[model samples]
Target: MKKFDVDSKEVPIDILSDYILKNPEKIYGIHHNKMEELVGSVFKEHYNCEVHHVGMSGDGGKDLILIESDKSIVVQVKRRQSRSKTETASCVRDLIGATLLNGSRDCIFVSTADHFSKQSIKHKEDALAMEIIDSFELFDIDKFMGVLNLHTSEREKLWKELIEIK
Candidate 1:
């Protein structure tokens, strides 16, 4: 099994998949909280957003908070060891509740599992139907956001330099 530096700002998608998605045997050894950190870092690097880790106890179902411009998006991360253990509707409901409670209309549910239960997908659709949430994106391993853009990398480097100077 391959090891990962969870604290790194850059995480290759293949490495993430090897441990979290493609290899079932390796998944059990993966640390759930560290996976959340990796996901948060990926989002921070890819979107150039301020990603905050909040996956501890009483996090209100949100693992990460992504702030971009004036919008704050709640993110829920699920690292399922078994492929059969899909994210359920209740998870979606809790995320919906959390999103509203956080005063944000947008949320994203991320899971290492290959897919979510049908009920979960319907729940997300229902939330949109009722206009309770402006956006509810469900991302499985294959559906994660794409690679970081060049501009984002440059921005990250500049930010690191500024931090070093301070």
Candidate 2:
């Protein structure tokens, strides 16, 4: 494995992809709770927000809650890598329910799928303050590729922690 230093840098997507492909199943097949933590970490790092993992046994409604300026952004992470249109719709509906239950207006559904069906997208758009982050946008990969800079050492530590998390 390569080590990263403390200078702000962008780790190439190809390199990260290659690393993921090395043990695709293990990395991708992590449990839902672990996935929530990974997603929360990504958001926390990218948005400079306080993220709390609330998705264990009795997670009120959301998997994580992102606190930013007196606003609580409820997040639900679905590990379903693929789902039909109806299933996607169902997931959105669930997110809506979670939002209402948690009394949070801002909500986000993060998934490891490329995209949701058109109907699902429309449904989410129609809902109140709902945002979907599909697989491609799941980790702000593009932002990471474009401008987001992280100390190489921090990035390395994050990568190591992600992969090593059971």
> 43 in model 1: Cα distance from truth in Å?
0.9
Give the runs in model 2 whose Cα sits over 4 Å from its true position.
1-27, 57-61, 81-87, 128-166
> How far is 39's C-alpha from truth in model 1 (Å)?
0.6
Clashes by residue pair, model 1: none
Residues 134-160 of candidate 2 have per-residue lDDT tens digits of: 211222222322222343346778889
The most accurate candidate by TM-score is 1
**Clash count, candidate 2:** 0
Model 2 TM-score relative to the real fold:
0.61
lDDT (tens digit, per residue) of candidate 1 on 58-151: 8889999999999999999987766556888899999999999999999999886778889999999999999999999988765652322333
Instruction: For candidate 2, give the lDDT.
Output: 0.58
Lowest summed lDDT window (length 10), candidate 1: 144-153
